[model samples]
Target: MIGFYGDIVFETSNSRILTFSELQRSTASRWAKHEVIGKKPTSEFIGPDLDTVSFTVNLNGQYGVHPRDEMNRWLIKARSGTAETFVIGNKRIGVDKWVVKSVSQMWGVILNKGEVVTGKVDIELEEYVERL
Candidate 1:
């Protein structure tokens, strides 16, 4: 298993074709600028901003992946506002769990019967911090 988001596992096998690539991570620090009297502005560090992760998944029918079903599952999670653990190779992604922020899909190949033969999906995830 390469990684997992909650119960959804990212793997490649004879029965399932789910693999991700172009993985990217983003993080930031909160800063505020204050104007000084007759002087230059000063910047103050507030705190760390929430981290985000994004990746692209290639789905192909030949590899046993059902694009529509996978897409619906991602949409469901995004709409439910649920937080899930994000792990990769036995390591957690961020300081806390994560939530599905957005999902974008593109169908590269489609059959005559309207079945997606090949597709690409982009997923965005954001850190989920619980209230202290």
Candidate 2:
């Protein structure tokens, strides 16, 4: 079986590709320094397991392999009152702000010779923001 997680793509003017995991690590590093202190850090996990922190992908859209010469870019949109946006890179570069027009859910499927498998994903941005 295949699994999916938060995946972001970044396109730089200088021709660079940035993945979501790379961006999250960078952001977490910066937050670890100033915000967290002493034994209990500000960014420390607060759930059943320390490893299961609420980390998410903040990508603008779907991504796939593209032919050369395409101007691929990474952009993110959030509401005005959103606080402490956890961007993968420097917010100034990684995100392009826009009003959220709508939110929706998506699913995927796979089929074999005699069987079909389906997967579902539901993301609620409002719920995540509330936790933050």
lDDT of 2 by residue, 24-129 (tens): 1122212232354456535644343111122222222223322111111111323333323233344422233222222232223333552213222222222122
TM-score of each: 0.94, 0.18
User: Per-residue lDDT for 67 in model 2?
Assistant: 16
lDDT of 2 at 49: 14
The TM-score leader among the candidates is 1
* Candidate 1 residue pairs in backbone clash: none
- The alpha-carbon lDDT assigned to residue 35 of candidate 1 equals 95
lDDT (Cα) of model 2: 0.27
